[model samples]
Target chain A: MLLLQCPWCGDRSEEEFACGGEGDIVRPLVPEELDDRAWGDYVFMRRNEKGIHFERWRHAHGCGRWFNVARSTVTHEILASYQVGDDRPELPE
Target chain B: MSRARHEPLAHLALAAAGETTGPDAGVTLQAAPYQPAVILRGESGNAAFLEAFRAGMGFDLPLAANHVNSHAGATALWLGPSEWLVQSTTGQAEHGRLAAALTGHRHAIIDHGDGQQIIRVSGPRARDVLSKLCPLDLEGPDLAPGRCARSILARCSILLHPLPGGGYHIHVGRSFADYVWRLLADAGLEFGVAIGGAG
Candidate 1:
């Protein structure tokens, strides 16, 4: 089982967490102004990159706090995890 | 004064049947019943919130994650950055005092009203029983006394509080108390487990 570090509760088994899809998907400031295509893209489009990915995770069974995790999809290695409101970490190119 | 209420486990007959006083028993289980439990929510970073909490509870709120702090008859477990579970063994008097203390503050205080149940297990093999179902490293220093963690045990979400001695006071949702008790019993069968009155 993967050990995910909960920003509030320290490292815990992955069973205690729920993976939210992609991270940092900001809601548009003016949703009413967007066209149908732009709205569709914003709602459904996601970068399913095979390499480094930023995802949201909730410690469902622990602290119940949602946080961000930078993980490599291919290797399943967690590069870093941080609180939800913190600035996104600078990832290597 | 409000009438005293019975806990969810109060109806169980096993507490009277199990051998709780034997020296040969490797584990002893009992219900820490009817404790007043409250959920306090507020920004921990807010000085006003902290001040109100201390003024009401008579102890500094534990800011460190997964840590617990106790004063007099109450114990507060840090559940999240802005949430805490406050329990008082002394009964509703302490609960009322705390509730009154935080009355004017910009915070939320929820009286759980026996919504949660505590199963106290202690003995030589207490840790062994927990290890069978929990994924946490119970032997590590991270779970020493005054420290607590939320984790899943037997697929049930639990708040694990390691006592000063070799046992734990596991808090689970009231609805799952029986299921969790049975799981613990089954896991502890080989250890000569003894259960006490469900009070």
Candidate 2:
């Protein structure tokens, strides 16, 4: 059971949250505007970086806020966490 | 007020605090010092009632329904299948008006504004404190505020409200209030943090 820090709710058990996955991924603004290849690129493509990855998460149980996290894909080690609007967080090395 | 299944321990703690127990228990009260809370049970179509209540109370806090919706400012917690705990620090009198507004909507409203206590825990080691009591995964960005959930802390069920300021707003039943307080004090030992009551 991994205890997660809510930044807002202080710290809580992981049971209260829902993992969104590799943060900073944006969906195409208009599905119809893009060609099938471009849409596929947006939907199925990713850097798939190994060391540090940016992920999105939602507080499903507490304040209900959505935020981003920088974590290690290999070890699930969180390097850092930040809110969505926090100065345009960069991908950690 | 209505028993919510998502966090059984939390309601159980409320029962223990309210001294209303047993299997048939429905609504339980938890006291909040200085600040009073109103627990509302809305029947079908009570969403409108909630909106009306918010409007009637002059609530401009920009409520968010935790467990139901995750936004910010204020939010409602899903207590049971049909009940919710509309939490806000505004005022009880205003809450009373909100409750009164939902009177005949097939909902049971209880003023739980004084049966629980609110405490905040923050700093880097905040998550470590909760791990001592709860059994959930709290890694990545999953536990941020605007996110709320329920769990047991020190054998008492608690409602956790994430604060955007790198802290948590914890609500525990009044009976175990002191116990939780003591536990937090001990938990914050390494951080040399301070535990103070919320107004």
Candidate 3:
């Protein structure tokens, strides 16, 4: 099992949390102004990075706070976790 | 007709199931049923709320992760950045006092003590029993008093709070109380579990 860090509750077992796919998704300001292809890209497109990936997670069984986690899809190693609004942290080698 | 008191774990009859099992019972469990529990929600950064809370409960809300603060017999456990669980040490109503104290404030208080079960698990094998049910590492000084945490216990979410001397208070919701109790009993059987008063 993975050990995920919660910004409010510290490191806890992965079972206590639920991973939300992707992170930092933004909605287009004017949907009507966009063509069908542009809207589809904004709605469904995701950067499935194999290396350091930014994702969303919630400490569902613990603090119940939603935070962002930077993990590696290849290694399954969690790089770092930060609060929802905080800027994406610089990756550490 | 006088309203009959309902306990969360009365059906399991924990007292009958494990009483008089002997002093050598490596683990002892006690139930504090129908106690008043209050879930307090407010901005931690708001000075007014903090001041009012202290004036009402007698201490600052513990802001640290999984930290517990006890003052004047009431326990305030940190649940989230802006959420807390306020419970009385003596199985009484700390909710009443807190609700009255925080009146007119922009905050949320839910008196959810009705169906919650607060069980005390103590003795030499306390940690052993918990290790069976929970995923959190319960070792060393981390599980000491003034510490509490929320984690998965036997597939149920529980608030594990450590008491002053030893043992822990397993705060679980009504639906899973019986399930948790049975699981705890099953896990502690090898250690000679006893259900009794503060043993």
Location of the lowest summed lDDT over 10 successive residues in candidate 3 chain B: B13-22
lDDT of 3 at B42: 90
In candidate 2, what are the lDDT values of residues B1-199, reduced to their tens digit?
8853233134434334433233332211222344546676554345676566556554422233334342233356654334566666454343656656666656666776567767666656677776776664455454565556666675667787666666677787766677886676666555454323222
Q: Which stretches of candidate 2 lie over 4 Å from their true place?
A: A1-93, B1-33, B44-51, B54-75, B140-142, B197-199
- Order of the predicted models by TM-score, top scorer first: 1, 3, 2
Give candidate 3's TM-score. Answer: 0.92
DockQ of each: 0.85, 0.12, 0.86
Q: Residues B157-197, candidate 1: write the lDDT tens digits.
A: 99999986668999999999989988998898888788866
Best by DockQ: 3
User: Which ranking of candidates, highest lDDT first?
Assistant: 1, 3, 2
Candidate lDDT scores, in order, read 0.86, 0.60, 0.86
Order of candidate numbers by DockQ, starting with the best: 3, 1, 2
Per-residue error (Å), model 3, residue B149 = 0.2
Recovered native contacts in candidate 3, as a fraction? 0.86
lDDT of 3 by residue, A1-93 (tens): 899988887778999999999999988898899999999999888999979889999999999999999999998999999999999988888
